[model samples]
Target: MQPVQAPVLGPQVDYRSLVVVLLSPLAFALVFASWTIFAVLGVELKRVLLFGEVQFAVLLAMPMLTGALAALPMALLARRVGGRRVMIGSLLLICPLLWAIAYSDVYLEFLLAGAGLGLGAGSLAAGLVYVASLCPRRHAGLALGLYGAGMLGAGLTYFLLPLVSQAYGWPMAPKLFLLPVLLVALLLWIFAEDAPRMPHAPLDSLAEPDGARSESPSWYWLPPPAVCRLALYYSFFYGAFVALALWLPGYLAAQYALPLKQAALWALAFTLPVGIGQIVGGALADRRDFRDLRWWVSACVMVCLFLLSYPDFTMQIHGVHGDIALRFSMPLGGFTALLAVMGMAMGIGKGSLMCLLYRDHGDDMARSGGLALALGGLFAAVLPLMFVLGNEWIGIRTAGFMFLYAALAVCMLLMLWDGARTRSSPLTRHSSQPPSQAD
Candidate 1:
């Protein structure tokens, strides 16, 4: 049996929803940029505060910590009252935090402000649910891809903040976001549409793909907790992409001896590709099931990580002529290429996985998207600290990549086992096949 498609909607609805989807990324991008504020701004702050690597990691991750904590509740709230209200309120909520960060000098003050950036995460949760609710199935991947591309806004600070900080000063940088955030919030308040909430129902993965016009069901309707499975898989791609996006400028500068702005620019090789790949992933996902696609995405990411994890090495050998020394390291170009490819793979995986989530849980995106983002946020929060710890314990600058490699390998293995077990189950076969074919 084929998957069910979304019911056809009138052209007016189609046009309105498309408009909402097109503009939705602005809101998502604003929240995402806010969520990742520390990535670039912290470079200057780190210099002023004279914090240790560990403390810097903490500062870098604090927003993610709070964001993860906030995602689910915001999602639940959106479910009851509708995503539009939650999203609008969430967008407006970050204004004070930005103002506070601009004025504060203390690390605690900054951290407290950073914690409020969790509202940015909640906004993302609301925004994702909103888009999922309105987007039709035929273009589901593209819709999610556009929403995911809001991560590109993280690059806005990466590219522009340093310039803003250089001229007006670091304090002035956060203020730049104030206008755009307000504008997006206002637009969403006026124009966004959310799927009407239905009576609470059990998890149903077999729900129709067209989310907005469908008889949308309640949260996590899939049996055996498919939402959790989707969340877990997406967490790796999203978590790693976000962690690296936040951590890479620092790593590039430290490892390559580049200036801060220069390093941030180079890190865009990673982030820009990740953003664009979301579109690619979404487009591809529209054509087929993404379970198989994710295997390729995961495998590509692993291969890239395997290469990236190897540190620069110097080798010596005694020869008849004389002692010979050979030095090997990833050149800037090679490293950037690999990073871009890895980012692409991660982006594609994220886009496809989100689409998969919608295919299974589109009717329940408020809960599903919230849980997924929450897990990704928590996972992202842990990665930088792990990178710091891995370096201290292992004494390799590339230790972060190594840790990611190992983590991915473990997940792949576990998923492989799970897939094998599921395939072997008679009940799984019976449930998967249509009634006409089950016999």
Candidate 2:
């Protein structure tokens, strides 16, 4: 067979590449919608199965754990074979698994089927690599930002799944997901083109002369410290975003005594901003210093978490004549407004973090982005358990916000420490870029 030709990189925009970039996010949205179906269904399942708080948390977390574990291998496969093929195959494979989930009668059966459906989440790893290959280096931030908007599918599920379940039945929810998954997969198969692969080279030998590195980095290169930092930030921002997406419908219903449909709508107060903020954040990262942007975003999130950390409190005062009582609590509208702001902050952080990852590891984005996402997903998985434990131990619904507050506090402290250290260095003063950029 003849060798595959290199992709032409012209000065003008490549409309073919742009089309692929646009389509990749739409495909991702469908897969993501399917992957997160459990979030909406879990609330109903809790009632049907008579599951306790911890068990419900486990049920919610299972798919995230499985999805995180699958990310690295799926990304490597995308790199080796082709992103388009991996994406199409993943979408096709998850359809039957979703059907199985819909048909599952026992809790154990549902858990097993949900694990299989988790593969749908791995589409992000492949989609990232696929979109990155099509866009120029300068545009990678915007491209990834646009692709990241596929997360809006999580919001879409929040809006639509409850309605679907109400209209058809809980079992029919996953079955509805089947239609879009197949449609997106077929469109991708017909229209999407995989990026051309470069010849094999030693991992360390691919470094650029000025140390900027090419678009395709080696798979075996050790991740820099920045990767871990970004992962932590992402875990709090993107991971927490995922956790809340799963948690919020139930949260609103329990906390405010809202109907399921109303609760889902309230959840959108958080989810919609996160989706739109990513696009705005991506555009900002392209023009501004990502380091500065990330710091500001983290600071804002820290404050929001602080406000959100408060649980309902009541105090009674004894007077000469009688007794007086006072209560302090955030109203639902106030709480939702805080979540909206927090979502925007997370969205900006998500966009900036991806930009940093692509800038530093563009060549190996499949691995690096996948690993980052995996780590973030792990946090998403664990936090739900923490939320349950916090609630059970503390006997307060808002206990989860305390956990988030602590996490964001740690992130803020680390950022400040890193910032102070960087400021003291003369070289860092000259260029505020990450040490990996020096490579």
TM-score, per-candidate, Cα-based: 0.90, 0.89
Per-residue lDDT of model 2, residues 1-439, tens digit only:
2223222231224866776778889887887777677777888888887878888888788878888888877877788788889888989988998889878878888788877877866677888877776777666677788898898888778888888899999988888888888888888888777777744432335465665756354445346676667666676787888888889888889888998888888988887888788878877777765877887888788788888888889999998889999999889999999999999988988988887777666666766788887887898899889889877887878878888888878877888887788679887555545543432
lDDT (C-alpha) at residue 381 in model 1: 94
| Candidate 1 residue lDDT tens string, 1-439 | 4444443221234866776687778888888787667888887788897877887889889988898989887877777777788888888889999989999988899889988887678778877877777777788888889899989987887888888888999999999999998988888777766656655442333355546334334423332376787888888888898899899888888889998889889989998999999989998888887788888999999999999998999999999999999998999899999999998999899999998888777766767888889989998999999889867767888999998999899889878977998899997776677754331
Residue 4 CA displacement from its true place in model 1, Å: 9.5
Q: Which lDDT value does model 1 have at 195?
A: 57
Point out the worst 10-residue segment of candidate 1 by lDDT: 4-13
